[model samples]
Target: MLVRTAYRLETGLREAASRVALRIGWTAAVLPYPGYGTQGRARVLGRVLLAPTATDPAARRGVPGWQRLLTLERPGVDVVVELGGSRRTVRSDEGGIVDATLDVRMPEGRATATLTVGERYDTATVHVAPDDARLGVVCDIDDTAWVTNLHDPLRAVWRTLARSSGGRRAVPGMAGLLQALRGRYPDAPVVYLSNGPWNLAGPVARFLEHSGFPAGPLLMTDWGITPRAWFRDGQAHKRSSLERLVEDFPQVSWVLIGDDGEHDPDLYGEFAARHPDRVAAIALRQVVPRPRERAVADDPPPDSDHDGSTAARAPSGTLVVRAPDGTGLLRGLRDALGVEPDRAGDDDVGW
Candidate 1:
């Protein structure tokens, strides 16, 4: 939330909306606080605690309990806030996706509200094209880029807590790597696609901004992805996401970096195969976790680890690549985005 802090220091946190106005559509329940930090950075906070919307007496009295509040995230992000007698779902067996129509006396009176799945960002999602001439770097966050994750789960959890509680922790050599990228393309903004979901938004943002991981448009998933949806999108979604980014801008070349720990290699490989013209290089990070640790922690199984013998076969004629560090690939953001360097270098960019 460096951005928010800087802004408050300049213009101060807006007190006018202290009571918490606005209803987040059940699909996206996020309160947008412009500049929660200082200067032009975002300082997100858990201040906007949310609950089921209050209603008139007649509306409140007439409610159904069977209308399951299908929980999307299987692990349950933290705690579920009761709907105050509102219809609730029994189970949302999906990864974090469930569909349940609300039952209300005045059915039309039912409105959607977004619960805090727990994440925040400073950059607006950027649209990119795979074949742009400008440099486009896709960096992984775990050990390859730094060393925040890929360690003892208990210690990692504690580090996460410390960030929320105002503790500062940094991954060695991460900021320098980011600065290195910045030096390469001072104008082209970077995007981070992490396996972490919206649940870690607040804490993750706190860690990255302080540590330096190109705090720009970060593409993260909501923990609420349905099991079926997760299965369906596993490799396809990530590949499509990167491709869509390439298509949206159409003026950059992609430098894909990720660790062999997850599906980064697979996704990057698929993108490279289908749009071979756009992808320049692929880098995989080498993790040092013990095999016992790997077996215990690799929940849901990382796709890359399994692809050692078998490869994902996509219709686009794309094949996945396994890597140890993302830096091995660098066609440049200009080539990845398909944008003119001189032109991209002059645009106003904070996202």
Candidate 2:
């Protein structure tokens, strides 16, 4: 009852704020995120926000992550999405997120969906995987792709809240590694599945592009309160997202990439066990604990013998590799996937 009461209060406050913002001449705008799907269906991802009519162009260049969280959500707004000669109207959720899957026959490769909220318009890119595409890549963002210092809570908060997209550092060689994956499986789709909030979608996309990572859809979750709980379940979100991917692309096998800093190992292990045939391999980035974290660690120290040198097999018979960074993982993946080393040194760049 207390939780329900809190949720109601939060909803009421947001509605009041939305009304005031609209009365003050704030206009509804659509902020689109890249989506992915099969040739028969496409998922459209975006958010509806109420923003000022006149915004400073200069200030928009490198807005800090914190400012993005302060957006006034225009929930339940109608957004018209046009793709593949079909037009459909979808309503935003309570969080102003427009996640609609439309049945439209688009050719394999890149496609665009036009989203219109009121008079404002934006385009979302949707990657349509071919029916024959068997391999896919799923990556975690935080410590796996970039340095978030998740071992230390305070530093992680500082990095997430204070840093701009350009200011945040990318995991060395990760972009080149992803590029190698793309080159090896040209038709395969690489999806970034992160636990980060949807508010940072723009910044995260910018970071991935600027850092030279392969372009793909970002599956992010919302922060704060949900219908049943005060805080969203990050682990549950990852689990459900992975399951949904299996349902959407039943023929595609995935190389799951994440870090051991948190629960990636356990989560990926569970998924691979459930869908053994769907998971091609599991790559875990071994994050060495910080001094403070080590002091309070409950588990024993990792064995030195198994540090990125050996390959293990999960219970599902899927190959598992552990590396400290992307370069090692790329090499391990090459051996596991039976791909020869790149003579052109493409994977050696962006370190």
Candidate 3:
């Protein structure tokens, strides 16, 4: 009883602190824009926002949702971004978020982007990997890579807030398997698409790095109401992300990796159906939400791939592999396309 009361008191204190912080007006920040671009002339995209200081740092630390609510938008602010020694000016929308894509031309290498909102400045760096990276891996982070209990949002929130960096566990051999999926290509990119709020980007990225997963761009969503939706939809965010990726890198063929914990299968399947030629394969991690949900030993449950059929041929010629875990996933990948995933850091990069 005392423990419960203490927790409630702590929560109340945090809420009060957050409210006080929100009332302190807005600060400008340049989000961690995707630092990746192609050779010749490439489009660079990022956002500028006027939000409470609580948003980015708290989100980076994986703080609870209540703290995140302190972030409110300040719109219509003119911002200037410096990219590759050039300056591009853009204005924020009514929601206090600015989406700007500037054209950059340079030889393939790493570049820094700087956003200046009056006197405040924020910077991000991105590498321009070769455009011929045909084999791309797109992954979902929640139950698929990091062990977040998406079955219960409250539990997930608690775990996220309570754990520090390196607290989250990788799903067994999933990290190694993801690295191996890069195949023989020199710069095969692995992009993470999650329904997780943008504030958690730092935590998620830290988790990935600590777990030995390959470095790739993390495409996460902004929490709360945006211009488009009253309550943001994960499905829509993922779909839009996929669309943008394909549109941006039409030359790259993608392999989608996700879990059956939620809508990954349906969304990935829908993507495969729409862009048959672009998707190489779909790998799904079979997860049992609750331990009690597992089948009794006396009567084994149905297999993840429908009665021991591991690979299914999608109408668009994409191979769908459903496996119990990462080991099974590796085996399925080998069977489907003779792919041998490489070790992590073969390219000596954290990005």
Q: Better model by lDDT, 2 or 3?
A: 2
Candidate 3 segments exceeding 4 Å error: 1-26, 39-69, 226-230, 289-309, 340-351
Q: What's the residue-level lDDT of 217 in candidate 3?
A: 70
Best first by TM-score, ranked: 2, 3, 1
Q: Count the backbone clashes (under 3 Å) in each candidate.
A: 80, 0, 3
List the lowest-lDDT window of 10 residues for candidate 3. 291-300
Residue 8 local lDDT, model 1: 50
- Put down candidate 3 lDDT per residue, 1-351, tens digits, no spaces: 555565556446645654555478556666654556664434443455455655553235545444544444445667787777667888876444555565776555567777677766676555565767677889899888888877778877876666654677788667867877654455766788998866566677778888988777777776654334445789999999899878877788788998877888778878887888778888878775332221111122323432232566655667777666776676666655554434473332111
Query: Which has the greatest lDDT?
Result: 2
lDDT by residue for model 1 (68-138), tens: 11112232223122121333323222233222222222111112222233342111122221222266666
Candidate 1 lDDT (Cα, 0 to 1): 0.40
Query: Cα RMSD (Å) between model 2 and the true structure?
Result: 4.1
Error of 2 at 29 (Å): 1.6
**Please, what is the TM-score per model?**
0.46, 0.90, 0.76
